[model samples]
Target: MIPLLFENLSIENQPVSMPLPNGITLTIKREDKNHRFVSGNKLRKLKYNIAQALTEGKDTILTFGGAYSNHIAATAAAGQAMGLKTIGVIRGDELATKIDVNPTLKFAKMCGMDFLFVSRSDYRYKHTPEFLEDLQKRYGSSVYIAPEGGTNTLAVKGCEEILTPNDAVFDVICTAVGTGGTISGLINASAPHQTVIGFPALKGEFLNKVINNYTNKTNWHLVHDYHFGGYAKVNEDLVTFLNVFNKNTHIPLDPIYVGKMIFAIFALANKGYFEPNTKILAIHTGGLQGIEGFNKERIKKHKSILDYEEKI
Candidate 1:
């Protein structure tokens, strides 16, 4: 029998409140604090992938991600907890002599994941058949491959569990789009009374194509303006917002993806895009460990001293 490490996830309905700028109240499902996986989204995406690996009689799993990818860390943890061997195909070739360990990578190593670094050019071809064949030859045929971010049809099916059925009507469902898996799944699971809004964390028009290719739904729209500088990049406003958000809600949102999404949601709501009484559920996709690399001083100089306070 496959181990049932993920069956006891706690579901907490996050608070709904009005924002300062526009006064439109939004309901947020803060799945980021679901468990040690750091987010409900991670749990949802990884649950079935791990199950499929074991069911198919595969003892090893191969996947792709950046050095700081939450998916990589989650995969490593899940693999270790589930008795499956894990290999992380990292983008970039600088893993050997890294001066400082990014927290995510450090945790992934602690989970017993083997890392293989590839060039940027080669990393782009990760989903190709040649890459899979090479990995199979290197790791043997017992390895099952999960796409980067665990964004697959099965992953989407897993994410549907995050949405709870409600009698109340909602106009829009918003989420940060990274690999487009969660948002695509949201689009699939949402009712016709709601429209799914995706805030893309990457550049270019490729996300639209990715979403379209995965699902035929036309109600989903991608907002490309609020990445705050691409994936893993941070700006002053985002940092300030993150700090204030953490202070107020005690919910830590990683500045790369979730932070940007929340920022965009506030911005759009303030601009009067959302009608009065329109319910908005912002899915907090989690990557809390990724926040370790952020320089608190550069973002909030006045409050940097708080970082030194001993936790009680």
Candidate 2:
């Protein structure tokens, strides 16, 4: 509401015409179109964070992320839109010189996010007081710090708003799990009969602890079957599926997050994972911003690139 960064964004529960089992149907919540830059869960996570920053009289916003992180790009644009100076603590120092070639970082730079590139080792201490103090020393302490991936209590509260009273009709709620904020919100707001499922973009059961901290609901479960070799990892098979999914549904998905979630959802639906007379709602948490970098990497590996977006 402060400077109105994302205005006129509302719930768009668009149904995807996927030919699944006869008893089940799949629909998608178009949270991705919330904003040009600050779209999807990124927008939800930033909603309260940005509001609090303004309420506290902070003039700057600082966040952490990887070179190709969607959070970094969204933060930079949201801060620019809200008239706040922004800083990005990038994980890889080497990417400092490659901003021209990196789409995510390039866009962040264009949005006026001051870049503080550090080595991977140094980035590991990003949570420690020493590291945070060093950052505050360089860029005033008034900077509202949104932790990497933008997953925090305030962010979780914003995400809980994703499901509306209309969404209660659906039997299952689904989302892609990154830092676990989106699904946690879904879990907290889910009806007793509604099951919340998370398709993790990264591997490991450690995210259970992260989600547990956000909500006390036990109706949610994470499907670890679709990591496809881990975070940011892709293959020819996945690319093939991505191309076909976009061609069929006309809903473009990012390689890292949405693609994996949709792929998993479709596979499960086809395999009769959903019982008869069941409805599944998946959150289209946008990350299409990373499509360019993902395609670039695919091209370098001599693999087919995902045709999710126009050439970068």
Candidate 3:
């Protein structure tokens, strides 16, 4: 059996830059700093899944993702570190020849991940029986399929470990929702007195159902107004906010997940949404590896890039 690196990680709370209403205390749980590549929720999500694979005698882990997916990058890195093979079924077939230009794919390739590029239309059927059967036939039965965004029963179980006894002091636990796995785990683990709030990075009402499938806890709610536009969508205000927030706090936020979540938290704070003296803890789900790809797109459009790096 392969051991996980830094399996018992100590996540710290960094106070958000001061000057807030009602004297509310806001701190971010730095889950992003958990690992170099397989950081944040990815580390937590993949922990037990990889263990299960090893126990089942699986030699390869196959997963699905888009061009700039953090899940794809993290899965590859974790598989490499664990001495297992990694295969990424990328969403866009056009990205096959562009791997060198795509930062996320490039990094995954560097970690020894093989690619199976598929068309967007075909990728939509990733969960369908026919598509899954094709994958099993192609990769052989020895491969364990990790769902897109790395959300599964085991993934949620792993995410449940994100919060410890020390987190009970927080009145509100917050995290960015991708496939709702992380938030679901948080919901199940949260104290009855605590409320779990998820800020989605995409536009949709479907996540409520996705989350419900894993947890029966009623203390969680989703805020849908802060996605900017949709998944992987961004605007100038968000970019500026990320740069300025990092400048003030010296904590780098990936533009995709944590950046949007932190932005929404501040917006809610400014709107007098949080109660007086409420202690809010936001989980920083890492995807900083995608920053290079994001900046590349921004540079092509002659726009400002994310100014912070993980080293900060």
Candidate 4:
């Protein structure tokens, strides 16, 4: 059944006029409309991963993510739908705390995923052989390991399908760079005449190295100035942008990743980054359900201000 979803899916040509705050127009690809694989960029990445696991005769899959990770939820759903077992290695030691279990984690549990808690110190070594060996010892050796955020060579190969049906010419293809897997795949799949722009949603140079490590070509560029205070962090400007973007485009973008990337793309295009006639394709990686707990957490954390605000 899971394989059928991949076979029956078609990448919809989501067309929209992306307007910047400064009054510039850019054409955007609305990948969020492709809802077969939980919508957007994740669907493409998971297609190949799931297929590979099946091909290898692996019945169980293990991956890493944070408490609010969309990757975790998607993996669980994909596993259940495909008749495979899913294990999530969550970061941090607060897994037992009820308040720490966000909506994404809750849904992951409902999807029948087994959860394992790890310390922050150990999370840094998630990709190490020793850590994987321990997991194998516990969960059996048939389990396939997927890197955090599904950012690996195989993940990139899956993402390459994002541009397969593109008969239209594009000047730039833009996407949010988390582990850099999507952007790396975009670069690999893009026509030699096209350019790929990646917006880093996290601060620091970590993603730069990730991209460099996976990709050898230089057609892709990473922009780091518009993270909106790092991953999962948002402000009034971001909220305002998201509200307007959804109202205008009818596409809901999670503030942490896709929203930041869209925000940066518009900001850059407004500054004349592209020729007036250049077409830009922006990939929307879906994580809308992840926002349910995020907003609740924000309100709880800022109870003082939220209590006095006009009840919407």
Leading candidate by TM-score: 3
- Candidate 2, residue 185: CA error in Å? 1.1
Estimated TM-score per prediction?
0.90, 0.96, 0.97, 0.89
For residues 196-222, could you state the per-residue lDDT of candidate 1 as single tens digits? 999988887888877776688788898
On the 0 to 100 scale, the lDDT of residue 155 in model 1 is 87
TM-score, cand. 2: 0.96
lDDT of each: 0.76, 0.88, 0.91, 0.76
Report backbone clashes per prediction.
0, 0, 0, 0
Evaluation by TM-score, superior candidate among 3 and 4 = 3
Better by lDDT, candidate 2 or 1: 2
Tens digit per residue, CA lDDT, model 3, 94-159? 999999989899999999999999999989999999999989999898999999999999999999
Q: Kindly list the per-residue Cα lDDT of model 4 for residues 1-312, writing each as its tens digit.
A: 248756655655566644554343455555665663356667677888888888888998899999888788888888888888999999986773642357777888888888898899999988889988999899987798888998888888877778864634777788888888989888888887888888888888877788787778888888889887788777877777777776776667777888888887777777877677667778777766666766788788773111212111
lDDT of 2 by residue, 33-108 (tens): 7888888999989999999998999999999999789999999999888889999999989998999899999999
Q: Positional deviation of 190 in candidate 4, in angstroms?
A: 0.7
Better model by lDDT, 1 or 3?
Answer: 3
RMSD of each: 3.1, 1.6, 1.3, 3.7
